[model samples]
Target: MINRIHIHLSLLVCTILEIIPMPISFGTYRPDWLLMGLVFWNMFHPQNMNIGIAFLYGLVLDVLLGYTLGMHALAFSLVMYVASIHHLRFKNYSIWQQSGIVGLYTAFHNMVLFWSQHWLNDAFFHLNYFWPIATTMFLWPWCFWLLNRVRRERLRH
Candidate 1:
């Protein structure tokens, strides 16, 4: 449907933004926008947003960034898997609740990425690594509102 495409395009935009360069400090602060999109999609379209799609999106991101094979794919799939499984609750929840859950979800995804970095190269954990969670939580309300607006306006056409 038109609504679905609108959501997908917005998700794509969020992913594209992730790859663009930012200031060094901003790099560390960049919230997990892609994960937020995944949560939104998983809540709205369980049957549509499957593990395979999540894997593919992550793979595309990996290829674009040339990090490695399956790094992003694996992490994204895991988080989205959780989202899809509990989508009923996510969809029915208030925006605040969904945003809170998404904050936790993005936090968990970033945690997995930190571990992935360690696995790729024996990197030590740092508290600074978790700061993006707070950034994501702070931005969640705005993003959810925008996404909801796009869904409303675009789909009504």
Candidate 2:
């Protein structure tokens, strides 16, 4: 029960971070914080954090960000499905390697969003739209360490 709360709270924080406004200069580079957290939880605690939970959180993010209702939900669910399937292999990799794989996952997520927006809203593809993939990859280690520490502490208590 406590672990579940910890997971949800962490995800909530990530969701909040995702929606916070940044300066125009940096807004284009904003990392996908919620996606990072979802991947982390899916990788580390798949039994508790599965695709369904990812879907729900994605929907929450969609609503919060005023995006199309199911866009984020679908992307997040697909990413989580991939993460959960290969979590054991992921656990064995070095952190840098893990980050690279996470980059691929983030890329996929971003691609889905971009594709959806293009088809649904006739949005133009911009080179800058993919910046979050690099930023998310760069920040993966720190995010992993913080979440791992929190998970340890929570389990210890």
Q: What are the per-residue Cα lDDT tens digits for candidate 1 across 26-130?
A: 888888888888777777677777888889889888898897788889889999888888899788888788778887888778778778889888889888877
The C-alpha lDDT values of all candidates are: 0.82, 0.91
Off by over 4 Å in 2: none
What's the TM-score of every candidate structure? 0.91, 0.97
Worst 10 residues of 2 by lDDT: 37-46
Regions of model 1 farther than 4 Å from truth: 1-4
> How would you encode candidate 2's per-residue C-alpha lDDT over 1-157 as one tens digit per residue?
7779999999999998998888889988889899889888887788999999999999999999899999999999999989999999998999999999999999999889988999999999899977998999999999999999989999888
Global CA lDDT computed for model 2:
0.91
TM for candidate 2 is: 0.97
Q: Give me the candidate number with maximum lDDT.
A: 2
